[model samples]
Target: MINICFKQSSSKILGFNIEGHAEYGEEGEDIVCSAVSALSYTIVNGITEVLKISVEHIIKDGFLQLSLRDNNLEEIEKCQVLLETMLLGFKSMEIGYGDYIKVQVEEV
Candidate 1:
């Protein structure tokens, strides 16, 4: 199963951590994994490349983590929309692949 944890600070999202694989199909044919990867990468690119906001992130096999700490409130607020969109994508995936993906939100 894949685990997704979103870190929230005072009502705003600070970052997220996603780990593990869906294992829903053959390694290269897992649609669940592909969907999750697409959403994650898109959000990261949208924030860093498009929005030009610096963030802390780590990516590797079966794991991806991203966090925002030093950005000013304005930048953080701007990132909120993309983050929320990613969360929504995850939740939508969870609805369809409940046995493969799990999502949790934690206050920090």
Candidate 2:
């Protein structure tokens, strides 16, 4: 499962925190983690450029967490769309059979 939280500091600004989890066969756990990490990296890298913001920090554990700071509604909205696309792509990947993953988003 993946849970993403967004915090808006202003009308045109917000931050995101992402957490993801997967239930995969033992041999495929690493692949699951790698896929999730890659998705997070793509999101942060893409948003940083699209929004012209800096990624303050990123942490990985059972899930991944990304924090960014930006003040552009247009960019933020674009980022949101990109994030959704990435998540959907990850969901569609067949890295492991009988594995399950989920993504969620929230405004904080």
Candidate 3:
């Protein structure tokens, strides 16, 4: 299962961590995995590219993370929309692929 977790700080989304695979099908054929991957990558790109936020993150085999290094309230608040949109996408996937994905939000 893919574990999708959001880290929050004082009502703001600091970042998100994604790990594991959906295992819904073979790698290239897994719709669940593909959807999640697309959403995750879009989140990283959208924030950095469109919002111009500098993200501190890690990317590796079966894992991807994204977060902001800037703690300014305005920047964090700006990121909230993108992060919450990502979470909603993940939740939509979870609803469809209940056996293949799990979502969580954690306070940091």
Candidate 4:
């Protein structure tokens, strides 16, 4: 039950939070965190040239927030696409693993 919340501020991408338990046990937890971290890294690396942004990973609450200073609508759109693509890839992997790991994406 990994929960992800995407927050939109003034139509320019604000940030997102990732939290919850993938399942019981340390291995499950680690896998969930690893997947999220990989996805976040991929997104940042993919759009680094297109948009200058800051990504914060809050360990205690399992939150990852990406904030963009530029308010360009095109940048926002690009970020959204990249983020979704990464998340979809994670979701596909989860399907094969079942409840061992999970990812939920929500727009806020």
| Predicted model with the maximum TM-score | 1
Ranking of candidates on lDDT, top first: 1, 3, 4, 2
The per-model lDDT (C-alpha) reads: 0.96, 0.56, 0.87, 0.61
Which lDDT value does model 1 have at 63? 100
Superposition error at 58 for model 3 (Å): 1.3
Model 4, range 1-108, lDDT digits (tens) per residue? 666656555543455566665663586457656776677666766777556644443445555556554446666676777766766776686777656555554445
TM-scores, each model vs. reference: 0.97, 0.55, 0.93, 0.57
Best model number under lDDT: 1
Q: Write the residue-wise lDDT of candidate 1 on 3-103 in tens digits.
A: 99999999899999999999999999999999999999999999999999999999999999999877789999999999999999899999999999999
Worst 10 residues of 3 by lDDT: 66-75
For model 2, what is the C-alpha lDDT against the true structure? 0.56
Measured with C-alpha atoms, the lDDT of residue 67 in candidate 3 is: 73
After superposition, candidate 2 runs with Cα above 4 Å error: 1-17, 20-29, 49-51, 55-57, 67-70, 93-99
Could you give candidate 3's per-residue lDDT for residues 2-107 as a string of tens digits? 9999998787789889999989999799999889888889888888899997878898878998876455778788888889999898888888899999999999
Off by over 4 Å in 1: none
Error of 3 at 105 (Å): 0.4
Winner of 1 and 4 under TM-score: 1
What TM-score quantifies how close candidate 2 is to the native fold? 0.55
State residue 90's C-alpha deviation in candidate 4, in Å.
2.5
Range of the 10 consecutive residues with the lowest summed lDDT in candidate 1: 67-76
lDDT of 2 by residue, 1-108 (tens): 445454544432255566655545454555665666687677777767756665566676764555445334555566666656665565465334234554334445
